[model samples]
Target: MLEKVYPPFIFNEFDRKNKFGLFMDVEKVIYSGVTKFQRIDIFETKAFGKVFTLDGVPMTCELDEFVYHEMISHVPLFLHENPKKVLVIGGGDGGTVREVLKHPSIEKVIMCELDEEVVEATKKYLPNLSYELNNPKVHLVFEDGSKFIKNFNNEFDVIIIDSTDPTEGGGGALYTESFYQDCFKALTENGVFTAQTEEPFIEKEWMIRAYKRISSVFNVAKLYLGFVPEYTPGTWSWTFASKNIDPIKDFNPEKVRNFDKELKYYNEEMHVASFALPNFVKKMIKDI
Candidate 1:
């Protein structure tokens, strides 16, 4: 440990400050890390003890995890007429796979999580979200998501990219045009893919660019918003691309079975409302 001792001259100058007060007690540090990664706790009241923040920023937790997981997984599943096979990229928590299994039509769900540590962490601290990791229909792949999609040949009905912000180095490829092309290849005809885009308020420029790239590859590309407080600016955005399906017309929630009865954010009304963006958001995409 590094320490410093104050010299007599410096101590004399510091003592001259009238605003100075005696030191108070220090508290325990729960979690700490740099931007590439950080620690978070999931049981704080203000956020419903669902999610936790470390170093003053929310990283991951249970409270708001279901919102993103359920929305990204079920939206495309509900829309598809027969979603037999599915692939998930970067959802190490297994929350997305858990929701996908609720659908009767799904036969197999393969997930590619680069970090086994993330899976281990979420399983230890967020059991509610990680419970379905060992389900029979679920197959875990410890590998690179972007690269994994390249070898896949139109074998899936839906591909959900539950990735972190691309600003993180490991998640960076998920935001690129090349990755979108790989996703395009990985989907069967009429297959749809959805991903959590960055905060719309903070990343308007990047959002526009992402939409343009997706549109170029697929016949339909759409952006939708869902509220997840743990993320920045309170709300978040998700982007979808489909070979032949229009996400709005493809919604069919009557198919979801084994309902958990614990969802806080997603519902039929919220499903329809999520696609309805405000005028300013419309303006940003219209020009592009």
Candidate 2:
């Protein structure tokens, strides 16, 4: 055991000092190693099933990975008029790629992940989530996405950033204002973008700062709420940004019918409801 360290992604201060933190009881460690980029740990737990963590933070688990993976993939894809090409940055677990492939209209997905090691680990221990990584439409590129997005101009229809904590090794770059500007310029005119911002209950400032960055670059930006059971925070957050499309006004509900039942956490109803923020949450990002 590394002792009960608060995973930094949850927030920098969630420890004995704050007297508040969450812990997942691990029964066994499935795989533990250090990638060149960051530490990787995959553990088995009675409650969360097989879990994956980066550094000391939990990334996803078998029990509830679908909630986040589904929300992140569907909302943006459905929001775009006809999302044929997509770019996913840092979703090495392949969960986001799996959900993106469900839409038949998707012609290609360029997965720009920094660490090939994390992709290999997830594919080996979390096969169900990683199975689609090898699909014909998915291209695996091992590099920094922040740099990769800059090379393209008006290319992808949707861009999803499923990255780790900003404080993790090399992760802070993804949250910067310049990085969002790169993403903003890499998309087609009607493109939609979404990123896993984090849980507002504990990471309100981080969440708002990220939302503000995206809001500055996009013609339209909205903050939506979702829940990841393994994340411990009561409500998780995702930011929806578009070049010219408003997530709600331009939402394509009819497109959801093609893949509705196959999805576990998202549907037409939740698509709209996710954007309806709680009063407290609204107060946090209201100024931005």
Best prediction by lDDT: 2
For each candidate, the alpha-carbon lDDT, in order, equals 0.70, 0.85
Clashes of each: 3, 0
Candidate 2: give the clashing pairs: none
Off by over 4 Å in 2: 1-18, 168-171
Clash count, candidate 2: 0
TM-score of each: 0.80, 0.92
Task: Tell me the tens digit of each residue's lDDT in model 2 across 1-288.
Answer: 234332322222334334666666667878988888777888787777888888656788899999999999999988877789999999999999999998888999999999999999998999999999999999999998888888999888999999886763334889999999999889898888999887788757788889888888888989999877777665788999987888888777877866644888899999999999988888888877
Clashing pairs in 1: 43-49, 44-49, 50-63
- Angstrom error of the Cα, residue 71, model 1: value is 1.3
Superposed on all Cα atoms, the candidates' RMSDs to the truth, in angstroms, are 8.6, 3.1
Cα deviation at 90, candidate 2, in Å, is 0.4
Supply the TM-score for candidate 1: 0.80
